[model samples]
Target chain A: MEQPEEVPHNPTEQAAICFKAFMLKNSPKSNLNLYDHLVRVLCKVMDERPENAVDVIEDLSLEVKRTGMRDKQSTLRDTPPVPAVQLLAEQQKTLFTRGSGDDVEPEEELVETPLPNLAEQSFYLEQAGVGLPREELQRIHLALKQLVDAQPLQTCRFWGKILGTQANYLVAEVDFREGEEEDEEGLQEDGADEEEKEGGAGDEDEEEATEEIDPLPVSAYKPPPAVPKEENHTGVNKFTYFVCREPGLPWVRLPPVTPAQITAARQIRRFFTGNLDAPIISYPPFPGNETNYLRALVARISAGTQVSPLGFYQFGEEEGEEEEEAARDSFEENPEFEGVPVPEMVDSMANWVHHVQHILQQGRCVWVNLAEKPEEDLEEEGDEEEGEEEPDEPEPEVGPPLLTPLSEDADIEGTPPWSCKMSSTLIPQFAIAVLRSNLWPGAYAYATGNRKFENIYIGWGMKFVGEGYTPPMPPAPQREYPSGEEITEALDPSLEEEQALQAALEERRAAEEEAEELEGEEEEEEEDDY
Target chain B: MGVTEDELKDKKALYSLNCIDWHLLPLPTPVLLAEVAAVAKGRFVGDPSFEYELTETRQQGEGDEAVKEEFTMKVTEEKRLAATVFNIEKDVSVVPRGAFIRTPHDTVQVNHSFQGLSTLEARNLGNYLHFTEPQQLKKKSILEMADLDPSIDFLDPLSEDILKGSWSLQMEGSSMCVLRSLLWLGLTFFHVPATPQHGYIYMGDGLKNLDLPFML
Candidate 1:
C-alpha cells in the first residue's frame, strides 16, 4: 500500500494513476482525506479538463472526509452523555430513513450499520466530472473488454497441455466424424425406417445394397446385446463416435454425444488447426499390438491425400476456399508426399507415422503377429556351424604355429611379462574388470585404487549386496521390568529374620503339638466331665 | 483461519510477486465454475495477494566455521526479487620444473562460482510472526461501512475471491519452502555477494539450482 509516486505523465500513465487511486480508495485503510489527496493528484496530472477534475475531487474529498471523521468519532471508547435509549432511538431513525423493506431491514440489522455507499460515492464523483464526457471512459472500457476476451483461449491452451491432451485436435475431429455417422445411422434405422418403407421398392433396394456392402458376414454382424440405460443418465449424442471395435468397426448401438463432449471436441480442433503448424494425431494405445490400422492411417495422411471419407473435409462452400488453401499449402510444404522441400515437416510426419505404428503395435488393444524368422534361415546357419566343426580337427596344426612363435619369444624373454600376455590370461581379467565396473562400481573402484569413485560406488553397492553383508540392522526390542508381586517380595523381610524375632511363638507351637498328642487320652476325661 | 484486515494488508505487501492477472481475463462459465468449486472443496487454500520479501545472506568465514551476513529487501509485487552470491579465489603461484611438471611453467588457477538465490524469507518469517489483537473500538470502520444486505450474496460459495486466495496461499507456502532451502545453502557455504570476478561460479551454481520452482 505504498502511495504511487507522482510525476508528469502521458495519457496511459494518467489512466494508471486513476486506477491506482481507485484501488486505494477501495482499500480498508482509505479515508476521505486519502481519497481527496488521490483525486487532487489525478486532477493535476491528467490532461482532462481541469474544472471537472477539480470539482469531482473537491466534492468527493469533502464528503469522504466528513464521513470518515464521523466514523472515527463514533468508534472512540468514550460514551456520550445521552442515555442508551436515545442512542437506540437515533439508530432506529437512521434505519427507518434508509429504506426498511423486509430484506433491507434484516440486512441492516445483520450489519448493525450502513455499509459504505460505494456506488453512490462513485456516481457523485463521475457526475462532478460530467464535463469530461463519456467517450473516453467508453474507449477504456472497450480496451479492457478486448484484453479480457483474449485470455481464456490462451488459458485453454495452457491447461490443455497440463491435462495431457497434446493431440486434442485430431482426437476431436475423429470424435466428431464418428458422432455424425452414429447419429445419421441412428436416425435412419430407428424412426426413419418407417419413412424408408413408405418410400417404396427403391429405398428397400438401397438398404439391401448397403447391408450387402458391409464387410462383416451377416452371422458375424450380430449386434452386441444392449444394456438398459440407467435412469437420470446424461446421454451422449448418437451422431458422434461413441466407441468402436478393434480394426475400426463403428459401434451399432450409438449413444448421443453430450454437449460437453461436443464443446471439448470443438476446442481441441480449434487448438490443433488454429495454432499448431503441423497436423497432430492421437494414437491411443491399441489392443493386442494390431498396428495395421494406425500405420494405414499414418501412411494415408503422409501421402498428402485424403483417406476418402475418413479424412477432414470442408463443412460448406463458405469454408471451401480456406480449406482448399490450407490443403494446398500443407501439400506443398509437407515433404511426406511429393511436394516442397520442407525437411522439418517431413521429419515430423515421418516421426508421427513411426510413433503411431509403434504405439498401435505395442498397444494393449491391438493384436499383432510376431512373424518369427523363418525356420530355414536357422537350419542354414546350423549347417555352417557343422562345417566349421569339421575344421576343428586341424586346429592343432593351426595352434602349433600360433603357439610356437609366442613360446620361442617367451623362452628368450624368460617368460612373457604381464603386460605382454595375450588371449586367455588377459581376456578374463579385462572382461571381469569391465563387467565389475558396469555392475558394481564401488567394488571395481575399490579394487582399482580410486578413492572418490569408490565412495559413490560403494555407497550404492552396499544397498544391493546380499543378505548378511547388508550394513544397517533393524531396531531391537525394548525390555520391561516386573512389578506388583516382585516389588512386594523385594520389600518384605526374610523368613529367617521373622523366625529369630518370634522364638517364643515357635516354642508355643511345639507345646501345642504335645498337648494335641495328649488330647486323645484327655478326650475320655473331657467326655466324662461333660 | 479467518484473516484480520491488517493481516490481509500485510499479506498483500509480503508476497505480491506471485500474483497473476487472472482477473484481467474473462473465463468461460464452466472454467470459472470449476475454479470456484475447487476452492469450495478445499482444493485451493492460499492468499493470492500476498507478497514475499527477498533477502540475501552470505556466510562470512572460511571452511567449517563460517558466520553469515544478511541483506534484506522489501520489494513491490511487480518487481522480480533475486540475489546472487559468488565465491572467487586468485592463484598467483608459479610452477617449477620437476619430474611430474616436465618443464618450467607458470599457472594461475582461478575458481569462481555463482548462485541465483530467491527471496522468500518473509514467508518463513510469517510462520513465526504472530499478530497482537487490536483493542476493540467503537469507531465505525470500513468493514462496518461496506455492509451489504443479507439477502444478497454478490459471490457464490465458489467465488473467484476464495479460489484465488486459496491457490495463492498454497503456491506461496511451496515457494517459501524452496527459498528456505536456498538460504540454507547460502548459510552453509562461504560466499560473497556476486561480483564480475566471481560471476561464473555463481552462474554455474545458479544454473544447478534453476530447476527450483521459486528461484527468480
Candidate 2:
C-alpha cells in the first residue's frame, strides 16, 4: 500500500534472515532439553494473546506430543549415537528433580516370599470369568516375586499368559526344595548324560540326528515310553516350567517333559510363537522345539485341564512296588479336604478330579521304555515275524486315572470338555467353582470356598481344533491301480528245436543257389569285357 | 499390601496366577458423554427430526450430492434377522466324506484328503455333505448325477434331505462326532473321530425352526 519506509527496510532484513533459518531449522538440538519447555511454550503464547497465533503454535505442539516426552524420544532412537559431549552431559541432568535423593530401595528387592494376593487374586479371579489384566496381574505379581527371590523356589506360581504370535508366554510354576530333588536329579543326570552321548553317537548318527532334529521322522516314531526316574516328582514331572518373554523377561527353564515330548505333544496341534526356538511345524511332526513343545504343552495342560474340586487330592500311600502301581499313586495334599459345593461345583463334570497324571495315549504318566536293546531287537524281529503279532498289538491307550472324573473327558460339541461355573450363581455357599477348559481355550480352574485350587492357562497355545485349523488331509490318492495279473500258459513251443529244423533246410537250398550264381557271374563278366 | 501372614496361613495351599488371559478383558473406558451432552444441549434444544435408521439404503442424489444408492433396499428388522441366520447357516453346515475339496481351481479347500469321519462314518446321515450349494445336484441331469465325485462331489447330500429323519447322529464322548439339527434348533455338527476334526455351531433364537414340518 505504501512502499516507502525504505522499501520495507530491505524487506524487514529478508524477514529477519528467514526467521533465523526457521529457528535454526526447527530447533531440535540447540541443546533442546526442550529449551525450558520451549521457553514455557513461548511464555504461554505471549501470555495468552492467542485468538490463534497459528492456533497457539498448534496448541503448543500438540501439548508436546502428549508427554512421555514422546517416550523419551522413542527411547532416544534406540540409544547408541550419543556424543556431542554426551549430548551435553544429557542436557545437564535435572530434567525434573524434586525430592530426588536418587530414590533408592531396589537393592535386590525380594522381601523373602509372599506374592499371591495378585490384586486379591485378580479380585477373586474376576468372580469366575477368570481374570488377568490389572496390568497383567501386576506384572504377574512382580514376576512371581522375582521368581521366589531367584531360585530354589519351593513354590512360585503366576503361570498364565501364553497367546504367542510374537510375544506372550509369562508362565512360572516352580517347586524345587527338599534338597532341590538331588539338584533336579543332578541336572537331570546331566541331561541324561547328554542324551546318552547323543544316543551312543551312531545308531546311524542317531537316525540322522533324529531326522535332522525331529519334525517326527525316525521311521514314524515309536519311542514314547521312558518316564520312570520314579515318575519325576509325580505325573508330567510335577511343576517346574518357567518360560518368560515378558513380565520383566528372563525366566526360561523348561526342560524336563520327555516321553518323547509327551508323545509328540499328543500328535501336534501347534500355535505358540513367542518362539523358544520355534520350529514345531506339524503334521505328525512336532517332536521337539518350542522348548519341547512348551514342555509338552505344560504336560498336556497339566494332564488334561488341571482340575481339582472333588476332595482336593489325596491318594498318596503306595510307597512300595512302584512300577506303575497305579502310577505310583502320588497326589498328596488333602489335609482333611473340604470345599466342593458351589451347588456341587455347578453340577457335574463329575465334580472335577484329575489333579494331574493320567496322560497316556502313550504320552506317559508311566510308560517305562521296556528293556531297550533296540527295543530288544524290535522284539526279536517281531518274534520272528508275527508269532500271532503279540496278540494283535492293541493295548497302548491308557489315560484317565489319576483322579479321573471330569466325567471322563470326550464330549466336544454336546459340551463337557469341563465347563462347570459357580462363583456366585446367587451365592451358592460363598461360591467359587469355575472350571472352564472347553478343550483348552484358555483353561481356567478356580476352586476355593477354602481348600483352594488353581490352574489358569490363558490361550492361543491352540487345541480346540475343529471349525478352523483343519490340517490332517494327506492320504487319499490311490484311486485304482493295483489288481492286474493275467497271462495264462500260451507259447508252448520247443523253439530251439524248431529253429534247428528250419536251419537245416535252408543250408541245403543255399548250397544249390551258390553254385548257380557262380556260373551266371562268370558269364556276365565275359559279356561286359566284350 | 494385604493378605500376608503367609497368605493367611495357606490352609491347604492353592494360591495361583501362572498368567494367561492375554488381551480382551480390560474393557471399561468409553466415557465422554459429550460434556454431559453439551450441558444438556445448552438447556434443551432437542428433536431436530430425530432418527434411528440402522440400515435402509436407497438415496441417489439430492442436497449435498447425496447418493447412498443401494438399489432395491428397505429390509430392516435387523436385515430380516441377518437374512434368516444366513439362510439357516447356509442350510445347516454338515461336511464329512473327505471334509472339503473341489479345488483344481474351482476353489473350496480344507480337504487334505480328509482322514476323519470313521466312527462308523461318523454315524451315517448317509455320511454327511451339505456344506451348502449343490441344491439337489443343481436339479439333477448330467445323466442323473452318475455317482458324482467332482472332487468330493460338490456338497449337498445329507442323505437327500426334504425331511427324512432330520439329522441327529450323536456319539459325543468316545471322540466327539455329534451332528444334531432336528430341522435347525440351534444346529450343532462337530466331528473328531478319525480326526481331521470338524465344526459348526449356531446357538439359537434368531428364530427359524418353523414347526419343523409339524414336528415330523
On TM-score, the leading prediction is: 2
Candidate 2 per-residue lDDT, tens place, B71-190, comes to: 432222322333444456467867786777766767666667688876766767777888756678788888857887887777777888887766666553235667767565557778
Q: List iRMS (one decimal) for every candidate.
A: 25.3, 24.1
Lowest-scoring 10 consecutive residues by lDDT in candidate 1 chain A? A155-164
Kindly give the stretch of ten consecutive residues in candidate 1 chain B with the minimal lDDT sum.
B90-99
How far residue A118's Cα lies from its native spot in candidate 1, in Å, is: 65
Q: How far is A430's C-alpha from truth in model 1 (Å)?
A: 47
Task: Give the Å shift of residue B177 in candidate 2.
Answer: 18
Give me candidate 2's TM-score against the actual structure: 0.25
- The parts of candidate 2 lying over 4 Å away from their true place are A1-303, A314-328, A332-335, A340-354, A358-362, A375-425, A428-432, A440-463, A466-530, B1-88, B93-158, B161-166, B169-216
- The digit string of per-residue lDDT tens for model 1 on B13-96 reads 122223443322121244433333222211111243334344668788898899888865442212211111111111011111
Candidate 2 DockQ score? Answer: 0.01
User: Across all candidates, what is each one's fraction of true contacts kept?
Assistant: 0.00, 0.00
Which residue segments of model 1 deviate by more than 4 Å? A1-482, A486-489, A492-505, A517-530, B1-84, B87-216
